[model samples]
Target: MVAGTSTALGWLLVLLFSAVAWYLSGQRRAGNKRGKLPPGPTPLPLVGNLFHLDPREMHRSLEKLSKTYGPVYTIHLGSLPCVVLCGYQAVKEALVDQGDDFSDRGAFPVFYRFTQGNGIAFSNGEKWKVLRRFALHTLKNFGMGRSSLEPRIQEEAQCLAQEFQGKKGVPFNPIDLVCRAVSNVICVLVFGKRYDYEDADFLLLLDHFNENFRIMSSRWGELYNIFPRLMDFVPGPHHRIFHNFEKLRQFITEHVRRHQKHLDRNNPQDYIDHFLLRMEQEKQDPQSYFHMDTLVMSTHNLFFGGTETTSTTLRYGFLILMKYPEVAARVQQEIDRVVGPGRPPCLADRKAMPYTDAVVYEIQRFISILPMGLPRAVIRDTPFRGFLLPKGTNVIPLLSSVLSDPTRFKDPASFNPANFLDKEDAFQGNDAFVPFAPGKRICLGASLARMEIFLFLTTILQQFTLQPLVPPAEIDLTPLCTGLGNVPRPYEFRVLPR
Candidate 1:
């Protein structure tokens, strides 16, 4: 009896010790996790603030969170430590002062799968460097700022004018028309020509592109990026997005192949021709990143970036004009004074139309297409505001804060062009108007985007005055979606002939 009791006691002690050890180990792990991270909202185990987040209005949610946690706050989305930077001062410090250390774009699995780490938008390191340099050089050569591209833009603008004329003062959805005009600009640059609006292939491509953009900003996109391994098993929008990406890839590849077949060494026409000729020149150099995959992805990036941003801005511009008719009238008046009906408005006319210029600036500031300004990663250990940000830390600069900061713009929430103009009614540029972003990773298409916005706005305003189709009480300019970009709710408007 004594021996049996002793043995039982020994076994109980061993089990007790094992339990204690396991408990201590878990405590140590929790402590380590806390130490590694900056102070943030307490999260549940495993999920880590996933349920607390609303992926659609993430910017608004983060803004509220910033108010509680101060300008710089950290949050965990699953295992990812997302550091949100609010206000202009914090954003400028990280993005501009420490550009090199913060230049790396955080690679999400879904984006990686889509882009395959090939394009300038998503790719990092030496590959991005080479492609970006080449893109800027090539774009400049193809008349990005020069007058050579003006005729092409004017051609597209004329088509737009014709479409508006066909509407004949009736209500119409300008989304498709605007998209076609913007897409043609990219098409001319990439494929060297424009497509007819009724062309079957062109329509299909546009639909596919639009669908892809929508899906990318949906809830499924957030889930797929957060838990890619698990989401891969599900059948839904994620699956469709993947299929669309593949289709786009194939389409771009075929175009690249055709360009290769018709390559001219001396006389290159369009982006593909230029790329193909360059590829041959760099064939002997093993370090050359110029190849079929990169070329296709770059072309795809240009198409996606060029079309979506410009079109969305124009869409918002019309919506804003409808919301504020007096503002629209002023813009039309400016257009009439600066650009007569017989002559098309040139870029030089922007200087003369101060109110028109201020309105465009206000639209960019108010809409803020890319609110988050793309996700950037710290390439090296850096100090931001006396805090140590380790290498690979995800830094998201909230550009909306800068544009909408009351300190910077009086009555930031309202759409007032006076925010950009002086008492003399002259155009006054502000350093805080950073819609296209700034520094090393600033938008490659800044000049092109500016030109497009100015030209498109002046052209449309010169021809028609946009007004709401519904009652003033029914019109809502509140954003309906936030993903790859912030898009306004769908609304109809009549374009009355000026």
Candidate 2:
């Protein structure tokens, strides 16, 4: 109780001091305009441009800002100057061509508070290098991009198909269904096992994940990132983000503890087991990055990232399919020809099914999940697009700019698979199709995610004809909310067995 009270007092002080800082910050923004930085709107004191940005849709706000200020511009988040990199040129120059210098994860208050730089997604410098390298090596050994792990995905795909089939042409929301399938895949990799779909405990855990995504993408999450100390003093659903993560952390810690009791160094069954083995090996090194906190956080990272993204992607993809029945028909036709009822779809089938592959790419492109993309910080004082970005400045690689760039994608505003196809109708890919931002900080599980999305999508589409309860014309494609992520509004659809 004392600790809670003390924590509350600390936040109150932070809020009070921050209010003064916010006021002074507004005065500083006018000076920033002439400071030789990229041109942007003059921010108000203390609040900076906080009120200028729409909390419900930051990507849209950032995208709109880019229109006036040019691709490379700066916006102040509170007193901090965040450089916004819009369009393909700005994003690529920073994230890809200048990858290493811009590789460090920019500090977002919510993730910083949650991760504390302990895991792959939010860590930086040598710590990020070590965790990322080890994770890649371990993932490779576990058959991330290789053919060896295809069967595991195929198995889950089959399970998902069965679950959908069991719904018996009745209307149901696919969010929870796909979340379970996706999260359980990470469970297999992290815990060395899968959860029973009907297990009461597993269902409860999934509820937490479902809520976390909703809250994290909601306005509450955005406000937390902007005014953390202030929000820390107050109470709202933003607090639920931490509560949910705590539950997830507790769950991960319990698994880690359980694994510690009977871990086999010689026969590492999963990511945790492998990490445990690595920790033991690095025990003698004082600067070792492999430790229990890293394990717990990284484990949580995989489970959190591994689930929400791909699951939400698939969920949104299906929603799109339901919206465009003709597109769905074309994909089904391609899938039926390449992968018949006799066999399930595999990664290899991706090559054989051009139309279906295009649909998958288009889904990712249209939705543009992580619309603003993950934030990156300048590693050092750097020259970029004719401007000097000082070290430690937070950067926004506006992926929405790339994915929806009118110059790159012919019909950027529309959902058309041909954007990823050609006149010859072969499966094609575009550099602008960077749903996973490129560079040193590119998604660690990109391959795994790709495999799951393709396999799960094909598996389900192959078996069932997804139809919205309402006519496709009536379906709304606009996201319900979009701050850090684009969350599709809830809708109902039915699965008719093919």
Candidate 3:
């Protein structure tokens, strides 16, 4: 009896130690271990704080979490550890000051499985350097940030205005019209020509892109990214994204075949022409990242970025104007005062039109599109402000936190253009206004997007005074959804000629 009792006590001690060790392992993953990393809400084993995350309003949820854990904190998605940087200071410190350390794109199962880390958006290190540099150079050469591209944007603005004019003051959903016009700009650059808005194939392609955006922004996408192995076999909308991506890939592949047939080495017409020329030039160089898959993926990246973000901003901008017609009136007044009523508004007019510029900035800030931003990864172990983020850990520079930092903005929650304006009514810019984000991974088309937004918004307001179907007070400015993209609620407005 004595021997048995002693053996039982020994086993009890061993079991107790094992349980304590297991608890410590979980704490380490949660960042709850003091001195190991920043503090955060404790995470459970395997799932790793999955229950704590709000799927739809992740940015808001994360913001709330920041309140509890402070600006820099860690949260686990499944087994993966992500260090989230909240507010302007934290994001600026990591992205701008320590750019090289946090330069790699974070791994997402969906993106990894689909893109295989091949494109500009997700590619890292040397591949990213080569592709991004070449893309910027080619885009600049083709008048992306130059005045040469102004005519193309002007043409599209005119076309878009014409489409709105056709509505004849009737309440209509302008999503398709805005999407087509904005997409054509990228189409012209990448494909060397723009298809008619009425074209079946063009609309079909847009639908595919739209569907992909919606799915990627849904909870299904988040779930797939977190628990990809299990989500793969699980029947749901998550699988549809793979289908959409494949279709897009097929379209790009088909385009590549046509581009090869009409290859022009001496004088390149567009992005496709430039890429093909580069591929040929580097055919003998085995070290070259220039290849067919890279071209296709890079082209897709340009298409995805160029279309979704800009077009959605326009879509959301119109919603904001309808929600606040007085703001729209002021913008129109500025456009008339600066550019006059006849000529199309140009990028040159942006400097002179302070009120209109403020409205544009305010719209972007209030919307805070892509709130969490495309996830970034630490290249190595990073000793952040009081936190030591491990190597290869996923980093989320909470862009919305910067855009709506209460310390910076007078009214962070409400839609107030004055947040971007001074007492003298001058367009006073805020360092926290990071719509295209900051750092080395800043949107490649920042200049282009800025020019597009300014020109498009001013031009539209120049020709039409937006009138909401219902009272402006009734229209909601809150985003329709908030997963991957902070999209505006679908609302219709009639365009009245100014």
For model 3, the stretches where C-alpha displacement exceeds 4 angstroms are 1-35
- TM-score for each of the candidates: 0.90, 0.93, 0.92
Q: What is the C-alpha lDDT profile of model 1 across 115-186, one tens digit per residue?
A: 788888888888889899988888888888677788778778878988888998788788788888889988
lDDT of 1: 0.79
> Taking the tens digit of each residue's C-alpha lDDT, what string does model 2 give over 1-498?
999999679646644656865554433223233235687999765656875688888888989988898999889876678899999887888888999889888868887898888998888899988888888898788787778989988998888888998999889999888988888877887798998898887788888887877887888888777776667766688888888889888888999999999998789988999999999999999999999999999988888888888988998999999899999999888888888889999888888888899999999999998898888987887788788777777888889889999989987999999998899999888989888898888888889999999999999988999988888888899988886778899988889999
Task: After superposing candidate 1 on the true structure, give the runs of residues whose Cα lies further than 4 Å from its correct spot.
Answer: 1-37
lDDT of 1 at 487: 79
Say which candidate scores most in TM-score: 2
The sequence of per-residue lDDT tens digits that candidate 3 reaches over residues 88-185 is: 99999999999999999987778788788898998999999989999999889888988999999999999999999999888999888899999999
For each candidate in the order shown, give its overall lDDT on alpha carbons: 0.79, 0.85, 0.85
Candidate 2 TM-score, C-alpha based: 0.93
Off by over 4 Å in 2: 1-36
Clashing pairs in 2: 22-46, 23-46, 26-44, 26-45, 26-46
lDDT over C-alpha atoms for residue 100 of model 3: 93
